[model samples]
Structure formats: structure tokens, C-alpha cells
Target: MTSTGEGPSATGSSSISANTSQISLADQFARSTEEEIQFALDEIRNENDKLEKETGILTKYLKRVDPKDIQTQIKGLEASPVQQDVVRVHKRRSRSRTGSTERLLKLTTEQKCDIAQREHDELREEINKFKHETEKILDTYRATREEAEIRLAEMKKSSYEFNRDIVLGAKNLRTGRVVAERVTRYFEDKMRSRKALIEKLRLKNSTLKVQKKKLQLQLKQKEEMGEVLHEVDFKQLRIENNQYLEKIDERNQELLKLKHSSGNTLQVLNTYKKKLNNLTMESNRLKLEISQRNELLTKIDKETELVEKEREKAESINANLRRQLQDYIVPEVLDYVQVRADLYELTKTMKTWERKVDIAQMELQKYQKQWLMMREHNRTVNPWATMEQHAAL
Candidate 1:
């Protein structure tokens, strides 16, 4: 009877120790989580402050990076001499009507370059800022994850110890009520703390998700801006190229006029070469006719007439060839012009197709997202109906 009474006391003491340990563990876990939450919040505030500082710096940098101002200074320095020369050239080519085009092309190119450079610098700054912000967020996520895991492990250990105490206490009816009460209190406290931590985590996760979406939107906008800038640059290059092509065409026309005037020398040279060849053929024919005339001198008059007619025909063919050659441009030059035209058309078509494809893909993605949302909504709202349909299937 003494051992049995002592047994109850011993079991009660052991149960009390277990309850104390469980409560201590829960308190420690709660404290650690609170500290961790506070630390995470502090880190977030610090990061926000860093971001603000970075933004301010970027703003200051932008104020210094005005490409237009630099371009204006450069233009001021370069314009004095160039303007005089351009005016002289303009007067000389006043009748050509090309001076205005040249001026417009130069102005547009300079403006486009300034715009592209400014945008590029801004993009570089933004990308660096985003990268820094992302690194900070990653660090915060890692720290929070590690702390959550540690807290979860502590909770599990405490619950296990509490459950063991309850199982041991159940063997003794006298202490069972006290152990059960303590365990009940422990569980209530645990549940309350767990709920609080979970809510905090949920809120944190929601905020992080919102921040993630905002960052993604910012990144997308930056990419779109970059593409737009690139297109502007490309358009500027195209305009300059067109201007160059116009100048080349004008030079080609001038060369053609010069060739028409000077080409007579070459044409005469070619005519002489042709006539020499015709003379060689005529000499051979004359030799054969002479040989035949030696055999039959009475038919010499008929042969002479026949040879004269052939010479006339040869002369007519030579005249036709000369006219054709005079009218023909160099084949190589013509081929180049035709190829350039084809390439331009091809580029235009390709751009149109690419734009259409991008639009179609965007539309398809939108439709797909809508379909997924509808499916999710239907499943959530009419789960029983979905289950019945599946069962029928």
C-alpha cells in the first residue's frame, strides 16, 4: 500500500515535470517566433529604406544624364562651320531640292540617338535596383523559412511530450484528472499560438505575393519600354538608310547622264572592233569567191551581189545590237537595285507577320487564362456536380 501511494506521487511529479516542460517549450517557441517576426519586419523596413535611397540616387543620376543637353552643347560647337558649308552647298544645289531632306535626316538622327541613350541609362539603373531588391527579398524569405521550421519542430516536440504524459497519467485514476486538465490547458495555449502564427504567416505571404506581382509588372513594363526604344532606333536607322539610298540614286542618275555623254567614245570603239571582225569574215568570203570565180569567172557578178546582200544584213544586226547596248544599264547595278527592293519588301512582310503572331499568341493566352479561371470557379461552386459528372464518366 505504501509503494502504491508512493507510485501515485511519483507519477504525479513526473506528469507535473512534463507539463512544465511542455509549457516552457511553448513559451520559448512563442517568444522565438515573435522575435523572428519582429526581425523580419525590421529587415523589410530596412529594405524599403534602401530602395527609397536607391530611387533617390537614381533620380539624381537621371538629372545628370540628360543626353539632349549634351547633344545641344555638341551641336553648338559643330554647327558654326557646318552651317556655313551647308549653306554654300545648298545654294549650289538649290535646284536639286535635296537640301531640306538632308537637314531633316540629320536632325532626326541626332534626336533619336539622344532619346535611345537616355532610355538605355534609365533601364540600366532600374535593372540594378530590381536586382538589389530581389536579393534582399530572397534573404528575408530564407530567414523566415528557417525560423518557421525551427518553430514547427519545437511545437512537435512539445506536443509529443504532452501526449506521452497523458498516456502515462491515465494509468493512475487519482492523478489522471489533473494531468488531463493540464494537457487540455496546454493544447488550448498551443492551438491559440499556432493560429496566431499561421495568421501572421498568411499575412506575410499575401504581402510578398503582392510585392512579387508588382515587381513582375515593373519588369514587364521595362522590357516593353526597351523594345519600344529599339524600334525607334531601328526606324531612325531606316530613315537614315533611305536618305543614303536617295543620295545614291541621285549620284547614279548623274553618272548615267555622264555616261550618255562620254559613252560615244566606247560605242565607237566597239563599232570599230565589230567592223574589223566583219572585214575578216568578208575577206574569207572574198577569198572563197575568188577561188570560185577562178573556176567560173562568168558567175562572179552574181556572187558579188549575194555577198553585198549578206554584208547589208550583218550591218543591220550590228546596228540593232548597238541600240540595245546603249539603252541597257549595267546588269550588275540593275540586279543590286532589284535585290534591295525585294529585301525591303521581305522585311516589311516579316514584321507584319511577327506582329500578327504576337497578337494572336497574346489573345490565345488571354483566352486560356479565362478558361482556367472559369474551370476553377465552376469546380469550387459546383463540386458535387463535377463529382457526379466524373462518376458518370
Candidate 2:
């Protein structure tokens, strides 16, 4: 039996080995696929970097323009006054045919000066206009510089935010990949284990089926032997039946005696039932008394609850009264006492102020007396008659 079991076990193990080999092959395929995806992502990143650099360079070139250079070129064109002078000189020569060559040449100098002066005035006006225009250009350049600075700041901030998001996204992607890989590996391993178990079960089932066939053959052989044994048992059962019939007759007599005793026992059971009925009535009476007591207890509980509620209400009222006494009565008394005390202190202060005023009056009188005495002394030292004589001279 052990040898037979070993044969099936060996077959089951072989099936598991085959399944594990297939799972290993599948794992290799998955790893290869991941490597390819990573390579593609890296290539795309390189291309994106190259494109961004090119775009940045092109944008800088397009924005590069010097406003001062444009202003300098316009000023140079405006400064050339030679053409205007030549035109004025030719016109004068054409109009003065009777004039001498020296006179015409002399007139040319005066005309050139006059023309140059007018050109200078015009150029000054143009310069003024250019200055006004250049002011506007400078204002526009300043605004553009500010806007570009703001845009650059915004772009840098956006780039930082985008890079942060990219970093977070990359981290999430890496984490997801790791989790997915682990899950895939776990499931693959589970599937391999299941396949191995299923193969083992299949082998066990096959062995069981073979054992069932063998059991069926053994059962057939046992059935044939059982038929002969059953015939011998039948003859013995017939002999035993005859002896059992005699024993049953004796048992029937004993049953008759038991029936008589049972009838007497029935009478005793009826007597006990009467007593049980009386006890039941008493028990019912006691149950009614208990129910009445329970009702009384319930009523008492309800009254106690009412009393408790009233006590709580009284406590709340007392607490409210105490709070009202503290809020209104005590503070009002204290306020009145404080006001009386302040009035008494104010009265004392007024008395002290009156005494100080009287002392000040006395000091003022003493000063007035001294001032009068000094005036008398001054009059004696310098006589009024001498002062009047000096004033007259």
C-alpha cells in the first residue's frame, strides 16, 4: 500500500515542477517588457530637453532689439543740412541774372547762413519731436522690460511647480510600478502554487479512482462470500425464533402483572394531581401578589422620579437666585459704598485745597508789603526833583 501511494506522490511532484518552470518563464517576459518601457521614457525625455533648449534660444533672438541704436540712426539722417542749402543757393542764382558773380557768391554765403539757420530751427523742432517720441519709446521699453521680467518670474515659478508635479508624478509612477510588480509577482506565485495543488489533486483523484475500481472488485468478491454466510445465518435465526416465542409467552404474563400495578399507580397519580392543582392555585395567588407589589414599586419609582425632578428645579432656582443676588444686589451695594467713600475723600481734598489757597493769599500780601517798602527806599535814594531836572536838560 505504501509503494502504491509513493507512485502517485511521485507523479504529483512532477506536475508541480512543470508548473513552476512555466511561471519562471513568464516572470522573465514581464521584466523584459518593463525594461523596454523605461528605455522609451528616457528617449522621450532627451528629445523634450533638446526641443526646449532650441525654443529658448529662438525666443531670446526674437526679443533682442536696441532702441538707442534706432534713435542714433534717425538723428544722423536729420543732421545732414547740405542738400537744403544747395537748393536755396541755386534758386538765388537763377533769379539774379544781372547780379555779378562775386555778388552772387557773396549772396550765397548770406543765403547759406540764412538757410542753415532755418534748417537748424527745423532740426531743433525735429529734435524736440524726436525727444518726445523717444520718451514714449523709452516708456514702452520700460513697460516691456517690466512685463518680460514678470513673465520670466511667472515662467520660472510655473516651471518650478511643473517640475515639482513631475517629480511627484514620477515618484507616484515608480511607486505604482513597484506595487504592480509586487502584486503581479504575488499573483503569479499564487497561481503557480494553485496549479501545483490542482495537479497534485488531479493525481490524488486519479489514484482514488484506481483505488475505487480495486475496492469495487474486492466488494464483488465479498458479496459472493456474504451470500453463503447469509444462508447459514438464516437457518440459525429460525431455530432462535422458536426459543424466543416461548420467552415472549412468559414475558406476556409478566406484562399482565405490570398492567395491574400500573392501574393502581394511576389512582395514586390522580391523588397527586389534586394536590398539584391546589399548589398551582396558591402559586397563581402568589404571582398575583407579586404583580401587585411590582405595580406599587413602579408607582413609588415614579413618585421618587417626580420628587427628584422637583428637587433639581428647586436647586436650579436657588442657583439662579444666588447668581441674581451676586449680579445685582452685591455689586450695587459695593458701588454705593465706593461712591460714598470717593465723596468723603473729595470733600477732604476740597478742604485741603481751601487751606492751601488761604496760605497763598497770605504769602501774596507779604510780597506786596515788601514791594511797597522797596519803592519808598528807591524814591529816597533818587529824589524826584533831581530826576525831573535831568529830564528837562
Candidate 3:
């Protein structure tokens, strides 16, 4: 009886240890699955972050490199070489506008215009294509991340039921637990405890079967992806890359052309710029001279007005003098009492003296004749005696 009881006890203990090992294995598997799910979530999050950073960098670089200047340069390159005049800005204002073109070019302006138009159309198409590619990349990233998040949510909800519903805890413990709890009611509750323990084991067994079915369903839900990116998307990217390579070749060819022409064109452009500077300086000098002339004209006008006023004053004085002289009849007075009257009086007095002198000349002639005759008669008589008597008297 003792050996038989020991054999049954040994068998029971071996079965209990096997059950414990199975439970431990299941627990280990559940923990490992949870860790894998968390690792997958972490990987998805990291990928999403990397994609976000790349998208942000792409947008920033796109924004930083403005294409307007490139477009402008392309337009200028395609423009007619004959059309030289261009709008010039000075001091924040337009100083000169493009002039009318003349003399038909070697390759007509119309042809160059066509080339420019074609280039513009091509550029516009390229920009739109780039925009579509960017949008497609963004959509792909968003779809993949959104799908991953949805799957992660479902996985998390399903895992929440694991702690409660999975066959994860110490499951075959009823025999020992009963013996320990019913120690006070040992002899009286033996049959009841055994029946209760059997009922608990049966219930746990049913639960384990249901959990197994649910776990199989979860396994079926695990998706198998054949590719990360679609073949079509890859092919489109390849086509774009080829197009970019072609563009690079074209740009290199254009750079070679520019280098070939740069020497002469640069010298000519410098000459033209120097001439333009000289012309601008000359124009400025002319404007300054014109301003000075206008100022001088103003000064001349002022002086003319002053001269006119002075002339009017002189004329007024002359008119007043003439008016004062108009009422007077006095002639200019002579210094010697009408000097002609004095000459007339002297003439009258001279005539009267001439008459008296004529009469006295006749009497003197008669006396002289008589004296001559007497002197002839008494030449020897008394001339000496008369002279001596006159001397004594």
C-alpha cells in the first residue's frame, strides 16, 4: 500500500512539474511577442520621424532656392541678341526703359521669341512634374504611416486582452490551495473542495481552448509585405532621374557655349557700360548747366525791371522840368547890357568925332599954308628973333 501510494504521488508530482513548465513557456512566448510588437512600433515611429525630417528639409531647401532667377536667366539666354536695350533701374526708380528695336536680326526676333516661349513652356512643365513627384512621395509616406498606426492600435487593443484572457498565470493550483485553505474544515470539506477544484480546472481548460482559437485568428492577421515601395513608383522615379540627367547634360553644353563667348561678349558689355556711364554723366552736366542758365535768366529779368524803374524816374524828372519851364518867357540875359546895344552906342559916338576931325584938318591945312608963305618971306628976317623971344617968354 505504501509503494502504490508513493507511485501515484510521484506521477502526480511529475504531471504538476510538466504543467508548470508549459505555463512558463507560454508566459515567455507572450512576453517575447509583446516585446516584438513594441520593437515594431518603435521602428515605425523612427521611420516616420526620419521621413518627417526629410520632408521638412526638402521643403526648406526648395523654399531657399528660388527658381525665379533661374527662369529669368533662361529667358534672357533665349532672347534675341539684337535686342540690346533693357530697362535700367537707378536709385530705386526706373531711369531708362527699353527702346524700340530696329534692323531685322540675322536670326529674326520672331524666331528667338519662339525659342524663349518653348523654353518657358518646358520649364513650366518641369516645375509641375517636380511638384507632382513631391506630392506622390508625401502621399506614400502618409499612407504607410497611417496604416502602421492603425495596425499598431489594433495590436495594442488585442494585447490588452492578453493579461486577462490569455492562459498566462499559474493554472493547476487547486489541490494545494484547497489543502491549505480548508485546513480548519479539513475532514468536513474534503469532498466539496475536490469537486470545486475539478470545476475550476474544467473552466480553465475551456478558457484555454477559446484563447487558442483567438491566438490562431491573431496569427492569421499578421500581414506579409512583398515590397516596401511599389514597382510603379520606382519606375516613375527612374524616369525622373533620367530626365534630370538629360537636363544636366544640356546645362553642361550650354555652359561650354557660354564660356566660349564670354571673352568677347564681356569686353563688349564693359565697353557699352562705360559708354552708358559717360552718357549719363554728360546728361547730368547738361541738366546742371540748364539750371544755372535758368537762374541767370531770373537775375537778368530782375535787373531789367530795376533799369525800367530807374528810366521811368528819369523820364518823370525831365517831364517836371519841362512843365516848370513852360510858364516862363524870360530870355537868357547878356553880361554887358545887351552887348550889341553897347556896340551901337560906341559906333554913334565915333561918327560924331570923325566929323569934328575933318573940320579941324581943313583949318590946320590953311594955317600951315599961311605959315609956309610967311616963313618963305621972312626966311632971313625974324625967324631967329621970334624963336629967341619965344624962348625968353
Pick the lDDT winner.
1
Off by over 4 Å in 2: 1-92, 95-117, 173-393
| Number of residue pairs clashing in candidate 3, backbone atoms closer than 3 angstroms, sequence gap of 3 or more or interchain | 0
What would you estimate as the lDDT of candidate 3? 0.66
Q: Write the per-residue lDDT of candidate 2 for residues 166-241, one digit (tens) a residue.
A: 4343344545433445445555775797799899999999999999999998888989877435767888998899
User: Candidate 3, which ten residues in sequence have the lowest lDDT sum?
Assistant: 84-93
lDDT of 2 at 310: 100
Question: 20-122, model 1: which lDDT tens digit per residue?
Answer: 9999867866778777867867988998896565445434434554445545755787543333333333343343343222221122334334544565787
- By TM-score, rank the candidates, best first: 3, 1, 2
Predicted structure with the largest TM-score when compared to the true one = 3
Tens digits of per-residue lDDT for model 3 on 299-392? 9999999999999999999899899889767766784568778899999999999999999999999999999999778766878877887799
> Whose lDDT is higher: candidate 2's or candidate 3's?
2
Error of 1 at 52 (Å): 34
Q: What overall lDDT, based on C-alpha atoms, would model 1 receive against the true structure? A: 0.72
Candidate 1 has its poorest 10 consecutive residues by lDDT at: 98-107
lDDT of each: 0.72, 0.69, 0.66
TM-score of 3: 0.22
